[model samples]
Target: MLLALRALLPFSLALLFGCSSTETDTSTEGAAAGIALTETGAHAVTRSKVPFLWREQAYDASLHDSISIITIDQKLAEELTDAERAALGYVTTFIGSECDWDGKANPEFSNLKCKTLSALKLGYQCSIEHLGFLQHWFRNDQEVLIQLASCPRIPFTASSQQTFDEIYLTTQGDTINVWFSASGVNLPMNATWEWTEENIFLAQDDAISLVRTNKSEVIRSELKFDEGL
Candidate 1:
């Protein structure tokens, strides 16, 4: 069975949810409901059985605030067991202004677990707006997966566009694995996805694309996954 679930906030609502250095409440007791503040005050998570957490700080002067999933839980990154790290999936730090393409200065520590979808490249700027995450768990198997994606604004010949990076995590028995993918294609702001048992159908404007869940491959087509649409 396809047990799919996702979390998102409309652009307008997401903007209201955006946090800044000065506006954030540093106290753990004052955090929003269902959210817990990390010891360092750099991250927060939903207080539930399967918690969903995110970076709270946008820029870390010492770190230059580059984009990364490994640093999401900085304190725990070093403390987590290999198996625990894998189960957590690819945790990303808060979106900041800079992008570390070479991974030299600001390396994403768990690179082996955080595999990319396409050749990494430079872009204009990262967007914190509409940043979202999704989680999926198999009923019959001892496996769970989560994806954290962000759309960044990229300059195009005719206009600017939004691109995404798909970060995923999966667990099996005592082992866990993490994966990352970049949507090399530029898409409109309204792009959306439909999940099926084996594939994800992406729709934007009048075009549709199919993403194979197993191989992490994409197939573009002018027709919709469901012809009726």
Candidate 2:
């Protein structure tokens, strides 16, 4: 009987180990489905969970006045964690605007518009006419690159039109950089000649400094990020 018990012990242990292994694999597979990691390894995680928070303060070198723009784009009402939603409550008073963050029935574009205008402070006359396409290119888990093909522009008046302005960003990891570019057609001749690129690098404490690629050009501005972004 002692010999039979010893022989059964090994089989029992093996069965237990097999069951544990299967359970582990099942759990891992379930997690993988939610995370949805691609084989290419470029995007370690999708943007659905992560909060896209950033504020950009751009200075007009010619006018010498800086504009503070805070953007919170995502399905914030639906996707934000309880903690994140609570964070919004703290800032509602300071944001100086009311928004009906109705993510359930709202489409992606309308949701973005509501999130942007509600969370950020803008002048009474200025209103963002449109929110353009947002493309997120993630290099890894720690790094995310975003390109705004047509950033929203607030026309001064109802009849006024806004030209297309493209912006790019590298958010996450250690350093973040942003670039703004725009072009327009010359009147009469109708030739598009002026296409400019203004690059800004992240500075200390929610600020960005102009990166002067041309040694001769004295173009500089201290673009700052808004708080609570």
Against the true structure, what is each candidate's TM-score?
Answer: 0.25, 0.26
- Tens-digit lDDT track of model 2 for 78-142: 44322222223222211212123233324333332233334332211112222110111111212
lDDT of candidate model 1 versus the reference: 0.25
lDDT of 1 by residue, 1-229 (tens): 1111001111211222232222322232332232343443111222222112232324434434322221232333343332233233222222221232333223322221121111111111222211211122121122222123333221211111212233333323222333433222212343322111222322222222222334434433221122431
Highest lDDT: which candidate? 2
* Candidate 2 off by > 4 Å: 1-120, 124-162, 172-174, 194-198, 213-229
Best by TM-score: 2
Residue 77, model 2: Cα distance from true site in angstroms = 13
Clashing pairs in 2: none
